[model samples]
Target: MNLNLRHAIIQNVASNTKEELEDTIIDAIRSQEEKMLPGLGVLFEVIWQNANEDEKEEMLSNLKDGLQKQ
Candidate 1:
């Protein structure tokens, strides 16, 4: 069966408030499960698409810092 995973994920969380979204993201990260990566990627995609240039720069910087910790 063909499934639109990205669309399905977006639809599933579309009605969530900011706090709920934050909790979902935090939980997904803390779970440390490979299955959650796609959901986090989707959330990052949404954030990137809506972010301004400065915000994007900040995100990139934060990502770089995060990677450096490993």
Candidate 2:
């Protein structure tokens, strides 16, 4: 088993449109299943990698707020 999960995840979503991607993310979150975490993590990694400083700061702020609510 030589699976590259990150690459696999990326590949799986590579052809999705914005709406489709949004649906996938939303469904994954709503499902509340542990298996979806890795896919969400990979999506977050992609978002973080592509985001600018301000976006990153916003994401961090949102994350902090989300954590506080938990």
Candidate 3:
């Protein structure tokens, strides 16, 4: 994402309620058709997979037991 895109995402998500965030995410996914799904999954999976390595061991540990605080 570019600077504007990053700022927009942060502002949008930070200012919204949980329901609104969920709705926005769903809408964004819908707007992208199926193509963006793979990209999104790839993003998550990259973090999930790489975090297992020594470099991210600490983060990986937290992720497993971390509270899903909204």
Off by over 4 Å in 1: 1-3
lDDT of 1: 0.92
* Error in Å for residue 53 of model 2: 0.6
Give all candidates' CA lDDT scores. 0.92, 0.94, 0.60
Residue 57 lDDT in candidate 3: 77
- What candidate 3 gets wrong by more than 4 Å, as runs, is 33-70
Q: Candidate 1: which pairs clash?
A: none
lDDT of 2: 0.94
Report the C-alpha lDDT of model 3 over 1-70, residue by residue, as the tens digit: 4556545545545676878766766786789877556444543544566564675777656767675642
If scored against the real structure, what TM-score would every candidate get? 0.91, 0.92, 0.40
lDDT string for model 1 (1-70, tens) is 1248988889999999999999999999899999999888888999999999999999999999999999
Best by TM-score: 2
Per-residue C-alpha lDDT of model 2 across residues 1-70, encoded as one tens digit per residue: 1259889999999999999999999999999999999999999999999999999999999999999999
Range of the 10 consecutive residues with the lowest summed lDDT in candidate 1: 1-10
RMSD of each predicted structure: 2.2, 2.0, 9.1
Candidate 1: give its CA RMSD in angstroms: 2.2
Model 1: per-residue Cα lDDT at residue 10: 92
* Candidate 2 clash pair list: none
Candidate 2 stretches greater than 4 Å from native? 1-3
